[model samples]
Target chain A: MTDLSYTSPRSGSRTANILLRWALYIMLGLFALFYLMPLFVMVITSFKSLDEIRTGDLISLPREVTFDAWRTAWSGACTGIQCEGVRPFFWNSVLIAIPAVLISTLIGALNGYVVAQWRFKGANLFFALMLFGCFIPFQVVLLPMARMLGLMGMAGTIPGLIFVHVIYGLGFTTLFFRNYYVSIPSELTKAAKVDGAGFFRIFWSIFLPLSLPIIVVTVIWQFTQIWNDFLFGVSFSQAGTQPVTVALNNIVNSTTGVKAYNVDMAAAIIAALPTLFVYVVAGKYFVRGLTAGSVKG
Target chain B: MTKWLEEHMPKLVLAPSFIVVLIFVYGFIAWTAWVSLTRSRLLPRYEIDGFIQYDRLFASPRWDTAFTNLFVFGFLFIVIAMILGLILAILLDQNIRTEGAIRTIYLYPMALSMIVTGTAWKWILNPGLGLEATVRGWGFEDFTFNWLVDPDMAIYTVVIAAIWQSSGFVMALFLAGLRSVDQEIIKAAQVDGIPTWRVYTAIIIPAMAPIFLSAFIVLSHLAIKSFDLVIALTGGGPGYATDLPATYMYTMAFSRGDIGQAASSAMIMMMVVFTIVVPYLYSELRTKDD
Candidate 1:
């Protein structure tokens, strides 16, 4: 609360200063309104009836809010092949996100520990190679990966998507843990080493215990990334295996009759719910993960 | 045996991921490079035919539009987002009481998937029933906001949506950069009767150049890889008006079954990424203590 940089504006009278501060508050509030507009529109539209949507203003509260559209979006909205809503795809995303986050986080913690604490030739180079994975355009690997997935007999399946996510996600996850672990002094590992602790022993006893914060950050990052992914989901999965985002896209984009605006908005909010939930619940850690992933140590 | 095991264990644990990166990341890049040079079709042929695919890719008009859209989209999206983000960041750094609440509202868009963003913006920008209609109802009888369906202006609509999604992230980065500024130096400037705006222009903003570059790299990378948003927003619509290289490459490989063009376009995208990223990696790795 006590920011040392706090200073009032000079060169203005008392009334002028008051006016300036009010202007600043109004500007911030207006920007906030701009940022919140799409969300506000989405929520209001999602709760309206089709008649209300057609007959009323684009941005207003529903005449009488209805759960019918949400229910349809969750269970009856149609993609090309079926009208089964987002249930199957939502579960598909859940299946993909949980295991991918866990396995990637596990590998990242170990990889990060060794890269940060243990010294060896080619370690940083290896780490650099892995880190560069985060930056490669996923398009470059699409053809080869598609072929490879087919060759391995995992194409068009959930496991295939998980493998793809974990492979691609390793760079960010490892970077997260490695950055966190580097701040941990090597003396702890050495002190344990003198007491005859082996590599796995020291990591298990020491590093893993100290990794709670980064683990929370990494899990949130990976979960959000994997859950909200659309390109990989659309490219790699078949009809039933599609993630919620892809399913939602199909439902919205494949309209044949009168367009269901309410259903479309409701479907979007549903598809966006998981990451939105994670962000709301643990946003501080989420921001930390994003800033950490980009800003160099 | 125990001593030997202890010494090699770190490498042992890291072997699987290192090997995966070597094959899946580096090895596949090599494979894609070969495919780009081949006369591949539905199935990839292993033989190289010396950039025939690249020739075809450059020849295609869709690829040309996608390529041009990349620049138009990237330049507008990055510049506007930076200006807005920097403005908001500077404002928020004034020790405002509502900084946390405002930052959360601004940055929440970054958490939602691009597809979700596309859906929301698509609806709002729709001509028949969206902003145009809403304004018309309010008695501006001749207002028209039809950019969503207009091929010429569709790409700008994407730029607007893209800016909304990421400008707040740029704000977050800049806010962090602003907070790390030396309080003592700012106080010293204030003591010299340096006006607040002058202090920011001369000292604070210029010092945040690295953060600006960081934001630039992030924004450009997102702009380059943008697919989901465009697909959900415009579907490369009216014609092939809004295709970025990513969507164009997808259409080639999957929709049209021209793996050759897809592979070739992929190589160019990779090259663009390498150009931006290689120098960054070199500088970052060189300066690190490890």
Candidate 2:
């Protein structure tokens, strides 16, 4: 072929490749924009004054970028006679979430260790039973759980809600640690056994240290689940012991009044900030934990 | 081991948790199932009702809508989440810059509860407040994004919001699977001058089958019990377009004061979940057995 013709063909293919690349970029950009639109609206609405929210376009720049909504959502919004924002429930949420995380993950790690290392006869059965429990909707068990809590005299308290969180969280947390433990080499546990380490000792010193990755995951997962849990928090407890989700819900989920979009958005975002903060900070380990959890032993 | 246990410690160390789960979780489940079979209403009454509750539940139009909506919501959620997840996964796996930041952005929604995130999305999707107004303000006088208001389209809005919350986890799963792929395979494809897309489509995707299955199972389970998103989004409204089984069960038990029928609805949902979960368990066990 002539040199000029060869160059022409090469340039034509280069142009085609450039066109394809631009098309792909545009498509992906559009998808990302659509994915982010909801978040964009939430952030913008949170910044706008309530009057601006009423009068201006949702996409428009806020005439006044005020922290008033944030302040109100956090401190002044009222669900009932009390005008406290979700402030009280914030402490209640933290109280429930911390213990819920600690106890659940500790037990989960132990359960995972036992199931993965020492397969007792009914161990698989136990795991299977727990796994099945995960599928039962909370609605199915809510009444029974409530009745049981009432019988135990722990109803409508932080401890009662914590118990509910632990019960519901057992499945996922066990699965997380169980799967992670299975990924670990059995030889390590066997070596610990040979060194005269009993179950508790080996777990405390070796298994526990090695399980930082999965533990972080379990903690993060349980923290977020318990922190933001609404059904258990709302149903298991009275108004006084309700978590931030319920408090946030009462602020935004009002049925009889004209809904305040800006306040609602701010409140929702406020409720989510703790979990979102964890995700932003320790999100790396969380992602690692998720991948590790998904991998089959 | 049995003989050793008999000689030393008879009860296992894990017995406490096992019993807790059995009595509280499993035992309560049995109790609830029993309640479904009885004439319970407004509260748990221990009197047998035969199949009366089930019959009534099957006959109710609201129940029918709830069941239909679940199937529609479940199918659409799984499909869209898988597709979008795959696309994001593939993109992230392409040696992209700022991987950590992008990964965080994607997975943050999964960490928050559906009530919180769903409420946010509901506001953003609301016609009067969110997208519709936003589009109209952008020099589009006739812009009509009314899915939030339309009875038929409202559920799709929920699906859209749910997909946003879940597909990130799916992407993370695929990314993990991608990371585990043998580096030699990609090198071999490069040596053979195969295009990157062809290589990913032909070779890597097939190898990521197990991860895909795992993601599908998790997403499907979430879709089935997806009550909070429905509740916070539309409250199953514009006339019950987004009513799911779990939310329906809630309304039946609490709002309508039909505890038996609600329990029956929960039972049916259990059966549906069993159909999905039993096979998943079986396949997982079989794979382990092999």
Candidate 3:
């Protein structure tokens, strides 16, 4: 590459600095608009009644701001004889997502702690295998997974779904925790060991408290992943046991019915709200967690 | 015995996950690959029927369209996402006000499921209901922004939506890299009379090469496996103009009940990803370990 270093002859002037400042602002302002456009439309459309939305003027202020669409989307919208909207599935999602995050993160912490701290024989081998498995597309594994679940009599059940999510999440979750743990000085674990703290004991006491950042990251990642998962929920869930994403997908993604753009947008936003909330609130930790060892070996 | 037990307790704890992965994840993947070689449909069968499945997969026009579309979508998505991400990172590095808020705004979309983002983008791009109608209503009836409906342009619509959804993630990754750049080097460059843009292009960009590579890999992986966006947005519509390998494999298995062909297509998709990623992985392992 040519040396791109430029020697400036012009002095830093009062007018030039101000222009540069405003230019930066204008550029970012435009970018923010681009980012916010789809979301703005979704939020507005969610507040509009179906009649107003049919006018198809997406940019105009809704002639009527009715809570009816939100109500119907959440409660009365039709999804296969359960005219009840997103409530049941929402709760199911919570029920499933909470346990999945907790169990998976716990296991992940253990995996990370062991892999980083212990240097056991073939430990890297195990980690590599798990990582390779992660790269295989989930669609390829669907049928055999379903078959295995069926054989185990756990297919379409919460435990089965939980197992699926944990297994799938194991790679990234382990990667996150391992990288985070590696960053912590070994002296902590070593000192705990000198005090005769058992492996799990040191992890629980010495390491766990220091892991709040990664815990938040893991919780956010696993929560969003398990919560918003469509393929797994659709594949493994029966009607009564489905997550909100499935219900939302059925309602919003149905091919043949007169598609309600407003409800569809609302449902989409609703499906994403919990995860989005976590991102906005704890985005710092999330970004930090992802970036810890971003330049991977 | 006690010493041995002490030495092995940690690995023993790791056993459950390893076993779970083997039996459930990898075992299932292997099983699926095996099924691709057999003549099964809608469900797995033990009967081996030669290379018949692979032959059918090769013969299908849908498969060809899907492969081509993936390359087109993948190339556009990766290139555009990288440019947009790098630019956003550079701009954000200019000591902007409300750093935290802007970071949150940019990174927020990655938090949403592709399904939701796809749906929202679909509405925003709809010719009858969205931008076209709104623009024409502002008195330009001659305006032609109907890409969403145009069969030739539908995949590009997907590219637009995908860029909107993912460039923020790339921005976040690049920003992290930019922040880690040594401030002293930048100060030295300024003292030497190097322009700000040149400083970035020459010093910062090369310094951030590893992060860039990692981000490129991550985004490429995402682009290759893109399914939720396609499913939600166009449903690979306008007679398969936007069809991709992942979505094509899905429809083949579920809708068409061609398990053999679906598996073959799935195998090919996996091969494509593995070919790109494995070489990258090998190089990383070899060079980084040293």
Best by DockQ: 1
Task: Give the per-residue lDDT digits (tens) of candidate 3, residues B225-281.
Answer: 888788778878878888999888888777888777778887888888788778777
| Tens digit per residue, CA lDDT, model 3, A128-236 | 7777776777888777777778888988888889878988988878877877787788887788878988887888888888888788888887887788788788778
Q: Give the alpha carbon lDDT tens digit for every residue of B1-290 in model 2.
A: 85576323313667877888888877877888999989888878888778888988889888888999998999999998988888887766544445666667677778778887778877777788677887888888898888988988898988888998888888888877787877677667666766666667888889888888888777777887788788788888988877888888888876788889878888888888778778877777668757
Q: Model 2, stretches more than 4 Å misplaced?
A: A1-28, A183-191, A256-258, A292-295, B1-12, B186-197
| Per-residue C-alpha lDDT of model 1 across residues A85-137, encoded as one tens digit per residue | 98899999999999999999999999999999996898888899998999999
Candidate 3 CAPRI category = medium
How much does each candidate deviate from the true structure in C-alpha RMSD? 1.4, 4.4, 2.8
| Two-chain DockQ for model 1 | 0.68
Candidate 2 to truth, TM: 0.91
Chain A only, candidate 3, TM-score: 0.89
Highest TM-score against the true fold, candidate: 1
Best by lDDT: 1
DockQ each = 0.68, 0.43, 0.53
Estimated TM-score for each candidate: 0.98, 0.91, 0.94
Interface RMSD of 2: 6.7
Question: Which residue pairs in candidate 2 collide?
Answer: none
- Candidate 3 chain A lDDT trough over 10 residues, lowest sum: A1-10
